[model samples]
Target chain A: MQLTSPDFPRNAAHALHDAALQRALGNLKAGFPGKRAAAVARLPEFEALRDLGRDLKNHIIEHLDYYLEQFEASVQRQGGQVHWARDAEEARAIILGICQRAGAKTVTKGKSMVSEEIGLNEHLAAHGIEPIETDLGEYIIQLRGEHPSHIIAPAIHVNLDQVSDAFHQHHQQYGKHERQTEPRALMNEAREILRDKFLRADVGITGANFCIAETGQTVIVTNEGNGDLTQLLPRVHIAITSIEKVVPTLEDAATFIRLLARSATGQEISVYTTFSAGGRRAEDLDGPEEFHVVLLDNGRSQMVGGEQQDMLRCIRCSACMNHCPVYGAIGGHAYGWVYPGPMGSVLTPQLVGIEHAAHLPNASTFCGRCESVCPVRIPLPRLLRNWRAREFERHLTPQGYRFGLRAWAWLTRRPALYCGLTRLGARLLRWLGGRSRRIRSLPLAGGWSAWRDMPAPQGRTFQALWAERQRAAGMEGKR
Target chain B: MTESTKRAPAAGRRVALLATCLVDLFRPTVAFAAVKLLEDAGCHVEVPVQTCCGQPAFNSGDRADARALAEQLIAAFEGCDYVVGPSGSCIGMLRHYPELFEAGSAWQVRAAALADKSYELLAFLVDVCGVEQVDAHYAGCVTYHDSCSGLRELGVKAQPRKLLASVSGLQLKEMEEAEICCGFGGTFCIKYPEISNRMVSDKCASIVASGADTLLAGDLGCLLNIAGKLKREGSTIRVRHVAEVLAGVADEPAIGDGE
Candidate 1:
């Protein structure tokens, strides 16, 4: 939760050279995209559903207050409480207060990016309570004392050996000694260790994918059934989420559910799509006694009706990051925040000040792959551009790049000057190319020359040659 | 879309080449190749007095300059029946000019008009001109890199490939991850060189694994980037624009090649 976004360039350099991290990212490059493509192909209506999802989320964001109020009323009617947190600190304090009131010695958590954003684990640990991450990736990263490199795959930066090392270093507390190399053994060991904690935990915490206004039920979909146990087995259950996750009705939620799993992991539906309302009734065999929902509005309310409003439509399916080549290259930790990739590039600036996370928005190829794959159709490239515009307006851009851009723009306004300068520049470059016809390095563009040759410019500008040919042909045309 | 039996457009369609800044300064052969292809398609071609499409400024968040350049560009190409260009990235910037202006302003309307008339070379050839094949050929096995702008923005995926099929001896050996970016993102490569290097390095690796002796793409920026990386890696694979190959204009040295 420390703001390391300013160190993005350095972090990116480190990630690019980290052999183990690169090896781990290789699996991601091959794995998710193919599966998502096949899943999307199998569902003929996927594109139409994406449109529907976008429209539905747009509607929800527009009528956010109404649906959130309706959700709160629904939760109250179902014998549950809704707690509002204006920011991360407030959210952490509210959750911690609930844990303290419950006399919780330990609490189990499912994978929740909202929790990460709020820095809830450290907040709770700063007090006397211990929090256990139930999801496999989350548990691995928790043992390693690292943040989730990715939104969905928390420990995606960690390889199998790294996982073995994490468990080897940390699992001794559970009376387990051997370092397990196989994934199944690690999973089994984690499950055996977590089962005891799950049974003994006084409170359970989880992040909601959706909180439906109509039914007062919060939804979470997971493959390992960790969420169901984390919420069901504990004495008290708390669902922590951001305000934008609220949807008007189950049908609207269904439209997104159909899009989410396919976009995230290529599953038709995750193995467990658990929906929890208020506390259990007499007929319930296994359920919590107390239920609470905490909604965090950390700088989100200010984004309404702005250029970035579309970002609220994100379902955290992470389709943007998965499809992004930049994310593919450097992985997520380089982003140096809880959110990473295209969504992070846009949102990190909004959440943490743009000045703190300037590189997040500036470091993109604008390939539009993130926007292409977004389920809710967020225009991530455009949004990133919006940040660039803001950064430029605020003069947050680095001075040298800004000056080069400024000088380039100034000359573009003067046709004659631009033409003259380009003609001379072309000849200079051609001469620099000498015989090989490529410059190994450039004066100001060291970044480009550091890795690739600068292709030599043709001797003359196209307009100059065309005009000359036209004159030779006795064609009197406008110059 | 490539039904060659279908009739071509009425002859003498007043198509003006935008001659993107890259083609104007870096590789004028691409513009000439574009002129040859358009003239062969029964269209009248004219080179417009235009330079940069205002993308660098627009992308760098300097809309003031982007709009000023956009205004000048729109005025310069006012009467052309269609504004076509050699680079999809620049033409994509043209298509996006409307977004740079206010919603219903006069500048916005004109920007939209220019955007509507613009087309990338390959898409214009196949879709509008109805040209199925080009009367050109080369013996080398070649791979195509789908520059992101042309592929995603203008739907140029099949246009060049369809035309490439009609060449006499150019074998289109497809490469993996052909649709990925080569990382010459105008200002992006310059600002974040290391990341761009990583991306282009991966792209070069894929091009090598495809085992093609030649590389062709619609946009010169990506071609230059890939060619530069390939050359730096000491590979002999040649790079050229798709238009150059289609118009019989690739007789000169390959991009980034000499002596």
Candidate 2:
């Protein structure tokens, strides 16, 4: 995933000028948040259940080393292989090794963000292995050759017309009939096209929402049954997930499940929520022949035993993004990464150095909506602020801005100097804002005037008003 | 000062008001409004000589400078009954200070004390101050925007509405996506103007759909954002601080109007 966040003015200009993106963002009004409210309304103890979920995740993250060992043992006992990768390179290498050993012709994949994080598709294609996305949303993006915008709804940024064109172009080549532009029609076409690929594929890869330490089961929740087929039908099944996604017990997993669906899609449960423990056993009628789990610790281990450890408790529900004002307008593309939203803001800066993703932390309005909606109650705004702090302390910020901040901070600490400067600034503004009642353009504030007029500050500062009122009251008392 | 005055609320029950830098400078009416609201509910209100809540410093990555401000704030509000503020951002800063300061430092104990009692105005009114309503009246269809700090950090969602609903002549029309952010964000508007403008534009559109003549919110930063957009777009919809609306003292015409 790309880690660059373009300059504020440039990115803002792009977001404002993009009319199509505006229309795309309109769907958020009735999407995740609306569904979540209805889902929460169904349960009397949703808040209590959230507490349970948060506690469960906290416990797992705290005892992560213990749980990982336990999970590995259980997976081995059940005839599945568990691989630990210290970083993206090792993870990608291990996956390619699995595919090469199997002599895979084609691999069908369910929607897995970990795959995107590791750049698996690109890596596999470079190594001469064909990987096809079977999930409806993933398939749309695959045809268009674009990245997933939203975590859950991968093709959220793509409208029906664009999808219709993709299907019309790809369906005939894949020996499937072209379909109507409707969402259901698009899904049906993709499902029909991928059905045979799923059966013929030598290997299948997926992302786990949670890995149960108690049973060595990788739990996945999906509205469509593609995840089930991707893991079951293929001879070789590989689950790729971050090390943070571990839970102590099935009961703990159940607690998080209550919050996960409600937060992500506002549903009581997804259409198909399946749990696969290990490779196919003798009694199992339908299961993958070989199962492998790759637990990737890509800069996540460092987050433990620190102030940001709470962030690891996230269930990847995407609720924070849905309710976030900054994310709502720009869509996920502006984030320039796989994870886009408040969680992405903090996580991206850490995983890919703050210098590259500096604009992400600066993207927020510090509006607390993301934190309020976060299932784990992560203090997202503060975390983003922490990233900004690191950026400054490391001298990663632009030099001009650093000097300006120093000057401002110097002036702000002293009351007399601050008041004097503010008075001068106010008089200057009053002079500049004569008669028209606005500043059309200013040297320092061009970004502000670009979109809307900078409202002129009223002549007197608050200190002046307060002082005058006090003097008037004193004179009245003397009289 | 009489001992009865000091002892009535008790030492532990004494409340300090962190008049946010914005409240102290831009809108003191909101601060006085908060004071009246707290005092009316029997919590002694103390306006401490607090500087900025370290938000600008903290957000800008000047943690060392932010620590100075935090240390000063913790000292100023030390041994107070409750550390309350009209601004949600200030309350948020207060609550999160323990994590910033060293554990065994003098500032940490003060920060913890401050955090325990730190509540946004509405949350203090509803929870600590035990205020259900403020017996006020206003004639208009008004919609409320939940400010991020107040809604998420302080959990002050229903408190402001509960106060507003008791006003006799006030008619509340729920806005579509009322909980969404208006995107003021202090320096964020200037920093990311296009994104900010687009977000505020979306918020303004939702306010228009609710058809409420007036817009009210807990945080001034958001009100300023929405108000600026409304004013720039030449919309007549009025924006007011929720305290002013709840106080029932707003008789003047809204922005761009003569009373």
Candidate 3:
């Protein structure tokens, strides 16, 4: 929840040293993309469903005020409360106020990236209220006192062995009475510990994947069923979600659901997709006494009229992250923000401003896998470039880069000088390569040549070749 | 080469080949390769007086400057059959340029035209030209890295494979996470060296695992990064532009021609 604009140097150092994190991240590169492809192959209507999903999200965002009003009104009518928080501080304060009024000593939470975004737990704990994370991944990260490296897998940076270590240290406190190293054992131990917390917790906080205006329901999709328990067992339930999570109807939500699970976890549907409207209705077997829906704007309103409005349609399925090579390498931590991967590359800069998050946009190979896999079809690479454009406009970029670009631009404008420089540069590189035919190190290029050899360029430019070929073919060349 | 299958339009397509700064300078052979590929695919490949694709400007966040250059490119590439490019990144820019400009502006109209005909080589090969195979062959164990723009924006995933599949004796072994970025995002490698190093290293490791003698990609930037890493590690693998492989001109210059 506390957004640390991670300095790239420090984050990269940590990512490099963090072996457990690497192992966990390695699993996602193969596992998630493979599953997603298989899932997409299964659904004949997948592309149509994606278009519907995009349209529904776009429509909801276009008329967010109406949908929010409709959703809030329905919640109020169903004996629930709705709070609109202008920013993270207000959202956190509202949740804290709810906890204080509930006389809540302990609060159990489902996996909520928005709550992480708002820094809800740290605020609650500072006020002397205990917050227990019920989701297994979130619980692991919570135990380790680290941020959720990934949106879907909060503890994606932790491997099975590290989870075992976390359990060994925390299990005694939970009275589980044993240390477990196997994934299944660790999961069972954590599940047993969280089940007790679920029952004893006075309040529940969860994130909504989608909030249906038609049903006036906040929907949560989870594989572990922790979200359902976190909401149902507690006397009071609070949903913290961004404003863009709203959709017009249940039918719209269903279309998104068709794409969401496939994109997120490669499942047809998450093991549990629960929708709760307000609090308990009369004759309900088990339900919360009170429900609160807190919609937080937190900079999204600024993006609505701009070129970046398309980003608001993200369902946080994280297919982009799973498929991203950069995310695969450094894991999510190096992005230095809660959202990592292609979405994070674009969104982090927008949320935190380009100066703080500038390195993120430049961190892509522009492989477009993220866009290809994105259910809502956010053009992430272009959006990232837009952020870069903003950075240049503000003069926030480093001075060396400015000088480099200026010189390059100046050279490019003059064909004679441009060709001369390239020919000379190529000759210099080829010379530098010598008998090895590869330059292992050079002053400015040492960074590149550090792990990769610089290939000697062939002396002539393509323009020269085309001109020669045109003359050979007896065509009057443009030049 | 096939006959031009003109789609219904009067906006009159005249495509300028954005022969990428890399292809133009280091690998002019690729530029010519792209020309042959595009012309064979049916569009008149024009070499406009263009330089960098404004990616350097765009990525540097000089939107106004990038827009200026983009405007110039739009003007230069105007009245083309289609603004085709050999590089994925440049083609991506052409295709997505309208998103950068105000809709209904003169620049937007030109940008739209530039994008409409602009195709990364393979996308132009299969999607535009609709060529199933070229009369070319290179017998080698090769693996393809899906450059981000070609894979995503242009949907060139199957086009390269479809063409490569026809090459007699060319074994195409699929690399793991072939679509994952090589992290050679132009300025990215220079700006964030540590993260970029990590990414490119992973990419190299995967390519090495494929036991590929040659790693092929549409984008020179990615190949340069991966090849640099592989070469630095002293791996005995060669990196060739997809065009070079497709043109069947990748082998070390036929026995003693230079000698």
lDDT of each: 0.90, 0.79, 0.80
Candidate number with the higher DockQ (1 or 3): 1
| TM-score (all chains, Cα) for each model | 0.98, 0.90, 0.91
Put down candidate 3 lDDT per residue, A137-186, tens digits, no spaces: 89998999988888898887788778888889878876666678778877
Clashes of 3: 16
DockQ scores of the candidates: 0.55, 0.39, 0.46
Candidate 3 runs further than 4 Å off: A174-177, A465-479, B1-17, B35-49, B79-83, B99-101, B125-133, B166-169, B251-259
Lowest-sum lDDT 10-residue window in model 2 chain A: A453-462
| Candidate 2 deviant stretches above 4 angstroms | A1-16, A177-179, A423-443, A471-479, B1-19, B23-51, B74-85, B115-119, B122-139, B162-169, B245-259
Q: What is the C-alpha RMSD of each candidate to the true structure, in Å?
A: 3.1, 3.7, 4.2
Report the lDDT tens digits of candidate 2 across residue range A223-327.
888988899998899999999998877887888888898999988888888999898889998898899999999999999988678889888999999988788
lDDT of 1 at B86: 84
Separately for all candidates shown, the number of backbone clashes (residues 3 or more apart, or on different chains) is 0, 3, 16
For model 1, the superposed segments whose C-alpha errors exceed 4 Å read: A475-479, B1-10
Clashing pairs in 2: A35-A266, A368-B148, B14-B81
Error of 1 at B228 (Å): 0.8
